[model samples]
Target: MTVEDPLFATPSSEDIERTMDILGENGVSLVHLQFSDIAGGGRTVSIPTALLPRVFRRGFRFDGSAMSGGMRQVEVDLFLMPDPSTLVVLPPLPDRPRRAFIYCWVTRRGGQPFAGDPRTILQKQLNRASAIGLDYRVGIELEFYLYKGESLATASFESPHVSPSYFSDSDVGTALVRDHIVAWTHELGLGVHGAHHETGPGQQEIDLRHLGGIRIADQLNSTRQLIRVIAEQHNMKVTFMAKPFDDAPGSGMHLFQRLLKLDDGTDLLRGEDGADISAIAGHMIAGQIRHASAMSAILNTTVNSYKRLADGHRAPAWATWARVSESSLLRVPSTPEGTLTDIELRSPDPMANPYLAIAVALGAAVDGIEQKLDPPGAFDENLVHYNEEEFARFGVEQLPQTLGEAITNLTHDDTMREILGHFIVDQLLTVKRAEWDAYRRHVSPWEHIQYGEL
Candidate 1:
């Protein structure tokens, strides 16, 4: 099956052979084929070096029933087509010098892209961007929490081991880990823009240079995988859990997105003259606002995600856009000239699939542009302070307060079904419903405390 050369142009067979030769020369013993499930966890299958060639040509088979949301039971043959461009040596598992990791594309029996695959969904959205004669570029700022692995037993998260400082002189106790993160990120060919301690203790942020379309998603997935793997090797446990500790700040995967027109390198997002952004940008923002409730399921894809949406945390409460307001859902950074003016979405947690998150953001923006939707005025004041009257005046609506609520909104939105395929939408709801149902059945410490002996 011949697929278009858009998000991923299948490389020539020679390219694949060349990559294999390099890996062989480097003494890579085992090839770990990796793919992402719907929930963004790394799924892997290891095959011997001897079978690498056959695996590359014919692809390898796996039990679809076992993987999450990617496949269903009843003998559906799934293929793992390795992308040669994603080959990188696993730093954490250096002992297996011959073991390398490569990202795989999930395909069905007749060589069709799996509709439920988040990676493929993002690619489809990028293809949509191409059809509109615009290129979607995304830069990512990834935040994570670092904790002492053994301290989980009895550690007071109220007081962190480190303080918030963008570039303070004091070293965070996890400086070594942060430095290691930088080194490995560079080694893996990601353009490391910067890394520093965030406003919260034990929380660190790493920014990657902007890349066009699917590369942004690829970098995010690979970077997260590398970050966790490296942290584990250092005898520490790292979490991207949105709100891992109650008193601590939540970790967010902020995506900075911009649209560039293909013709003459003109940015469709901003106007040519020295003024406000072009009409396309306005419409895109409008589309995002129109579908805020629906998009929440993808952005905040976990039960714990709602914890960040409440006041005090940086999570966006309203679907407003602003060049100055950081509290807005779509924050336009006011950087100096020549720098890209991008939209910063604060809703996404590090736990969600980066590809799906980006896809949903872009897809909603595309809808707005297509419909020429008008965005409301900027909310300069803190949305948390808005009273019922003020909120009603400004058309401010609160984000989904829980996973179940988000899913309910998503289920009714036709735009979500159009952007994310029906299959994917169904799969996401199915998995998340199971999660919510399981969570409801569990007895919690809070429950016990609330009515222990009333």
Candidate 2:
């Protein structure tokens, strides 16, 4: 069967031969078949290099029943179909085995696409956009923190540096390690616009140039792996957690999205005469806002993720759109050319599954267009600063304050349920509800300090 993905091209026999040759030249003895699990964690199946021929022809079988994120009903075997176009030789790291990585597609028995596969779920959404003669393009700003790995045992996130600086001095301990990361990112063909020190010590941000279709999701997964590998090489560690420290600014994966006409290469969100809000742009924004609460379950999955939403350090609390408010869920970012065509969503954390996150956003915008949804007017004033009386007048509402609340909102949103698929949704509800319950029952240090005295 033909792959429906916009970026997938069937690999020729010659392509397969060349990939094997390059692996030998790079001194690689293992091949890593990579795919993302439902919780956005990267899963890999490693095998010896001698088995490429059998892998290409018959595919490698694994027990999917044991691997699923608690959503399985029966034991079934799944196969990994490799994408040859993503071939790259990973750079050498300390005490690490050299391996060539190939991103794979999960298929059920007889080579049918697995409904629960994260990559398959995203591809379906891309096809939907293509059917309407439009393409979804996304640029992501990924934020993460670097820590001295040994300090993790103490429960204090110890950074290599001591202060918050926008751009750290070149002599910082993690500076050289950061350079190695950027070099390898370019080696993998994921173009880097730039990297810099963020507001918190040891926190760094990397921005990639935007791409269309499933490539963006693929890029995010690959990039995260590279970051972890490089950090381990230096005997350090990195985290993409949404809220790792209560005193520090949380790491968020901000999404900058645009829609383009499939045939003519025209940007559909392009505003007339540099106006902030275009007709279709307005509708897309409205549609996303209409489903914002439900979409939060996909964008911010963890219980700790909701802490950042309380918003004193540049995160959103209200589901409002604006030109420059950091506390608004969506912002119209200013560009060098003064074009406000792209929509910037600030809520998604680095921990989110890029496949599901992008799919939900694109699907919601498409719904907006089909339903002619009208978004409320954009506000310039900060949303977190608003009083309850002011919020009611603008028809504004707060986002889900906790994971349980967000999961409840998701169950009520039929549009998001349809977009994310019932199988995925069912698994998420069961998994997340349990997570919420676990967190509620666990006692904390603050709880002991307050109630123990009484």
Candidate 3:
């Protein structure tokens, strides 16, 4: 079914009226119709109040090729249909008034869902789960670093701690930015489970409640945007960079995934009779571990991402699963019997695209179910000791060590390339290669200091 005509029941007339009332009450001057490109970057075109109804009924059309990795030049004309349920009063800038934001899905001219669209990719994964009589529930854990001021350059790594504990008084600059982020996140209708000051001086994390992938992905993208906006308001800066500062911990995009079967709405990962996990749960983890090497390019894409992949930085240098270990690539959380049991993919960095991240993860899990794969033995000791020989024996392989190697792995893996499609794969390679070329030419302080006098 098309996104506009969801197989599920539509929102009631009363709900529509209430949404209109809310929009009017909020004094929203314009509506920002937003959708994600294939790279999971936000792209939008604003419409004034007078044009919203007409556009809402007929939807809006634009050239699909203009969107990065969306479509080829020959096949253009993408359509956008907004979700009324997603209407929210957008947080305004210093000089701007309130505006509403509605998430949209892209489609072809005849109203078919665009295959190259990242959102559609995720929707297909969700639909596939439905076909198997399973429902997927996801929760995202967002980690980010807060910087001193609104600038591209990072603070020196040697700086002392300027931020306090979550509840304690922080330095003036950090406290002001954190408060703004927390307040605006709540104001934007995000169900922020909690916000806290991380261990590092300028690091922070916000936990979000469990929700479906569609909305949660939207929230993830918007949350990143919110951090920057709110930080700017306080004259500070925020980064989702995986490894911005050389010596500090990097940000991660951790997802908790659970499956519920439609037959009787039972959590598939839980066992009713015993303490052991369900067979299906074991298989799912197995799939993730099996595909972990191929999936690394998507999970940890940026050049700096590998900087955080070293031992002791909380980056999973090894491909392993665990029931309770937070350091594993896939963590199966321990929960009470009869409650939802989930496996968390912990390798994704904050810089990864939310839609692509979710798509790869869900696709891997679904593969697990279809193949009936069983997870390998779990590890209690640290995984960093596994060298190439040991990793091969354990069926574990080190992730790509550099962006160049990552691109090669991603391009060569037929499964990942087939799943992601050529458009996305090619575009990602082109973009990242350019970034590498630019970075390779740079003479950084590390290089200068190490070689200048010697």
Candidate 4:
């Protein structure tokens, strides 16, 4: 029983011993073996701390059929082998039992990797990049909303205006939540750049410093869980829904990505002039733009996701790139002298599986570089406000307008299907199509009000 992927390198006996020592010293009573499903949902199976040594050697087995995404009842047995590097001790919060968490690699009973596992899918993509002498760094700007409960109408913190309330000190609730998140993130060893209030009422954003692809994905997943736990502690509810309210701005999980050379840690996207973007960067952006429509399926991932892409919400709705406009799908920020340059992809919501979303994205960029695709001219203006003639003149086109449309694009695109294998793509399409069908059949209040009387 051997598994040999650089991303899933088996933990050495010494390394496992050291981690066990830390858990024992911290009085950790439970260990959470966590993994993500194909639909971006987190699933976990907890084990008593006494089984740590057995887990390190043989791994824990679970029923895969009970989980969302792939395995059926006939092929249900799967194993979770913990990754030692991802171990994080729970903060000593009052009334909460001491526990440690670690992410795991999904494998079959015989120790072969599970292709249907979202984390494994991501690692395969990373392996492809590594084979080419390249690696990637990712930073996330995650926006979410705090509400009283299931009611979207009641914000936890009330504000009247829609103007950008970047960091107003007047809201005590927001301040407390933000501070707690920052502190807890720091305690968990996930570097936090900052947190602040966003434009929508009760909306907030957290910026994480850049890290390697796998590490950042793990942190983002953990951060989402932690936010929910902290929100409950304060007797509030937090949602990463793309568009929680029709009239308010949508929350987005904006991704900042940069590619680097594996050998010397040099940024491959930085131009020699220090002021211009490198050719490789252009190709990457071009790749993103070319595949923007298909990529939306994974990036946005929900029926409600389309609601956030309305004309005036600051979300990017078109497949275009720009030098600095927030309205563009890809925004290339001005690189300060001697600083690294990166691209910001604005379509993803927090609902997506960070692992799969980033893997597909980087895979597309690699495709563009290999084919040497040239990008269109950068659109430096607000695309949402563009007229038909202007849009045609700029060669800009709107992204897929609905979940169905996005799925169609995803199914038809050979590149995306290749990056995410036929099996994974088939499973995703099946799940999303069912979701779309269910939504289509349901009648909403808006529909009832508009046409039910007729």
- Model 4 ranges off by over 4 Å: 5-7, 153-164
Which whole-number lDDT from 0 to 100 does residue 388 have in model 4?
A: 68
lDDT of 2 by residue, 85-117 (tens): 777678765577788888888776656777778
User: Which residue pairs in model 4 clash with each other?
Assistant: none
* Residue 213 lDDT (model 1): 58
TM-score of every model?
0.93, 0.94, 0.89, 0.96
lDDT score of residue 399 within candidate 1: 75
Model 1: how far is 358 from its true place, Å?
1.0
Candidate that beats the other on lDDT, 2 or 3, i.e. the better one: 2
**Winning candidate number (TM-score):** 4
Across 368-439, the per-residue lDDT of candidate 4 in tens digits comes to 888888889888877756876788787877888899999999998999988888767888999999999999
Clashing pairs in 3: none
User: Cα-based RMSD of the predictions, in order?
Assistant: 2.5, 2.4, 3.2, 1.9
Q: Sort the predicted structures by TM-score, highest score first.
A: 4, 2, 1, 3
Largest lDDT belongs to which candidate?
4
State the lDDT of candidate 3 residue by residue for 240-347, as single tens digits. 878777657777888989888867878888865774578888888888777777787778877788887763676787778877666688887788755788888888
Residue-level lDDT tens digits of model 1 in 324-439: 76777888777667866677777788888888888889999999998999888877666667776887787777778889999999999998898899987888899999998998
Worst 10 residues of 1 by lDDT: 153-162
In candidate 2, where is summed lDDT lowest over 10 consecutive residues? 152-161
Q: In model 3, what lDDT does residue 182 have?
A: 75
Give the poorly placed runs of model 3, Cα more than 4 Å off. 1-18, 69-71, 91-94, 150-176, 385-388, 437-445
